[model samples]
Target chain A: MHELSIALSIVEGAGEEAARRGGKVSVVHLRLGQLSGVVKDALLFSYDLACEGTLLEGSRLMIEEEPVVVFCPECAAERALASIQSFRCPVCGALTPDVVRGRELELVALELTYEQHAASATPATTD
Target chain B: MNNTPHPPRLPRLIEVRKNVLKRNDLLARKLRDRFRAASVFVASLVSSPGAGKTAFLEKTLTALRAQCRVAALVGDLATDNDAARLARAEVPVRQITTGTVCHLEAEMVERALDGWNLDELDCLFIENVGNLVCPSSYDLGEEMRLVLMSVTEGEDKPLKYPTIFNTADVAIITKIDLAAAVEFDLKSARRNIQSVRPGMRVFELSAKTGEGMDEWLRLLQSRL
Candidate 1:
């Protein structure tokens, strides 16, 4: 599944972010879109495989699904779409051509422990 | 041994707003720059299986080769069937046999063109794996992306898979010669496409009969 590739990217990105923060990530927050073409369940499954040896190993993936928004020309307003199949505006029955959101695939934040903060604050000292 | 109470370890939150496909997107942008600098026009074709994408490409390569340097990279889950079928057009064709992957990514394309000289070719065509779903998310750095839907398929194909149509530059309705036999509703197809993507360019063609090949070829040439 393409979710594996997407999961790999997320893991790699989160690992980089975690390294910059000098901590081990415990959870990764993601914003998934309805039309992003990524399956959340599949991505969650692949995330474990991607983080086997990385900084995000055993980390939880928290996904927040984004809602679809369409621009209604008849009403001249943006309306939230319940589904992609039916583009008919909520306010009016006219179909809209513009889609403003619901295509997001973003990594929003990372949860870390105090041990990670300590790791970043000081480097190993050698005699 | 003495027991002592220890303070609680706090959990910290780090904010990072980054697209999960950023790496692929960055690579695609670089590839786009490279193609632009070389003056090579790149177009990618994507469609569901048995939609006649290979046949269409074969006809296109045969016609386009008469005027300019043309080559193709075809992707499939298995077998070199498509690449072999396209090679008969008498142009360079390579098959990226992705064992199980559903879609072709930018890295696969970049790797496929490793030693090829982009300046030598006036145009390059990448025929993606026959999948309407996963391919929509991966950008292969093509200047034009064509999504094909055959008349045999339901007219609501675009509505069902709007994401693919949303990401595509043009929509090609194939197997038009059998439209009447299949009772394909042309009006509904057009309306459905419009519903998903307004003002999208559409080409109705029959690769078997070459009915609308001339206009399609002319459009490609004009774009080049």
Candidate 2:
């Protein structure tokens, strides 16, 4: 599966982000789309292999699956597809090929642990 | 030892919002720039196993090499057979044997061009690993991406795997000579392709018989 490659990239990218932010990663948040051609279970299975002996070792992988949406030309409205494979419009029954979403494979956020919380909490300070 | 209470460390959330395929995309973009700078017209082919991608490529390479300098890079999981098959056309060919990976990434294509000079070649064909699902997500920096389907694969292949059709620049229906033998419905195949991506350019041909290959060659020539 290509998910292994994707997993490797995700872990590598997260490692860079962790090092730049000066913390150890605890969890990685991902936004996976239904039409992204990536299997979530397969990615999760390979996550451990990709993260072994790296900065992301033992870190949790959290995935948020995005739904596929298509813009129906006949209906002039956006439709959310129940089946990711088919692009038929839900209301108009016409095939809408204009995909607006569900191709996302983004690393949205990283949860990190710091030695001292107060020192790293810049937004919590009050004069 | 003095007993003192300490607060437990809490993890803080940091926003990344970076594309996971960014690394591959960036490399692919760099390759695109290189190809453009070298004045090379690159076309890539993708298909399911046994879709006759190598055969089509062999025919295309032989025909195109007559007037222009041509080279090819073929990918397979464990065999150099495809490379050998394309080499029969007497063009410079390389095989990228991806050990366990199902698809060829941009990095593999870049590495395969190590000894070859892109400026010397007028056209380059990258025949991807035989897979429809995984290869659809990868971009190999080709100017045109062709998705091949044989008459034996049935008409609803586009319906079953819309992602590949959506990603492809053109669809080639291969093995048309065997369409009648296989009872392949050409109308339904065309309809299915249209349903997936309206107004997509499609070509049908049989490399074995050279039927409809002239038109396909003309399309390639126009691109070059």
Candidate 3:
């Protein structure tokens, strides 16, 4: 899957972020969805290896697994789809009208050590 | 982030939740800006193995090279079969042998252009490793994304793998010459494509006979 490639990029970027923050990354959180077209296990398998010898070497991988959610008009119910291929609702067998979530590829934020001393800056202002 | 999980396992809940694909998206945007500055349009093609991707590229190179400065980078899990095939067409081609990898990433492309001059080319075609599922996820800094399916494949390819079709800007139907040989239903194929990507453009052409290639090239030229 493209997860390996994406994972490699993450390691590279996380390394950069750690350098910017003056601390090494300890964990990398990914928002993987059912429709991001990513295989979470494949990506997890590649992350540690990809992060080897990099700034994110010891970082852990965290994933927020997203459910396949779709809107059903016949039953007027928003149902969870078991498979990406499944479109019919289990409650009413109604065909899904559209997807509400579960298709996103985003890098929301990076969590760093937030060293309290790091926030200290030379104040320059005129009162 | 080192507080405590309501229910924690030994997997170490380190808050290293960083976006892994940010670099690729950044590099892709840089590449897009470069392409726009030079007015050179780029497109990546993805398909299953033995889907005539090389043949299609060879045909396309032959047709477009005379008019525009055309080049290509072909990726495979092994061997340089595709590069050799495309080289015979007398165009600049590079082979990227991705050892043990299933798809081509944007970084590989950045490395492949080390010697070559990107400014000299008008259109660069990247033929990704033959996999419909994997290549759909990575962006290769291309202005267009062409997901290909051959006539020999089932007509329901779009329905079967809607993600690829959804990611791709266009769908290319290869090996139209063999449509009759395989009893390919062209009508059903068009409908299937439309179902997945509403109002998406399509080009049905056989790289062998050059059938319907002009239209395909015309579309490419128009994009540029």
| Clashes (N, CA, C under 3 Å) per candidate | 0, 0, 7
Off-target runs (Cα >4 Å) in candidate 2 are A74-77, A115-127, B1-6
Worst 10 residues of 2 chain A by lDDT: A118-127
TM-scores, chain A, per candidate: 0.89, 0.88, 0.75
**lDDT tens readout by residue for model 3, B100-128:** 88888888887887787778889999999
Task: Show the lowest summed lDDT stretch of 10 residues, model 1 chain B.
Answer: B1-10
lDDT of 2 by residue, B3-87 (tens): 3533655788989999998878889999999999999999999999999999999999999998999999999999999998888
> Any runs in candidate 1 off by more than 4 Å, and if so which?
A70-77, A86-89, A92-96, A115-127, B1-6
Docking class of 3: incorrect
Candidate 3 wrong stretches, greater than 4 Å = A5-29, A44-62, A67-103, A106-127, B1-17
- Candidate 3 lDDT tens digits, A20-125: 5454456677787777778888888988889888767777877778876777788787888776654567688765537777765544455554333333331111
Whole-model lDDT values for every prediction: 0.89, 0.90, 0.78
Ranking by TM-score: 2, 1, 3
Alpha-carbon TM-score of each model against the true structure? 0.89, 0.90, 0.74
**Model 1 deviation from the true structure expressed as Cα RMSD, one decimal place:** 3.8
Encode model 1's per-residue lDDT on B1-224: one tens digit a residue. Answer: 23443344567788999998987889999999999999999999999999999999999999999899999999999999999899899999989998899999999999999899999988999999999999989889999999999999979999989889878888999999999999999999998888777778899999999999999998899988
TM-score of chain B of 3: 0.90
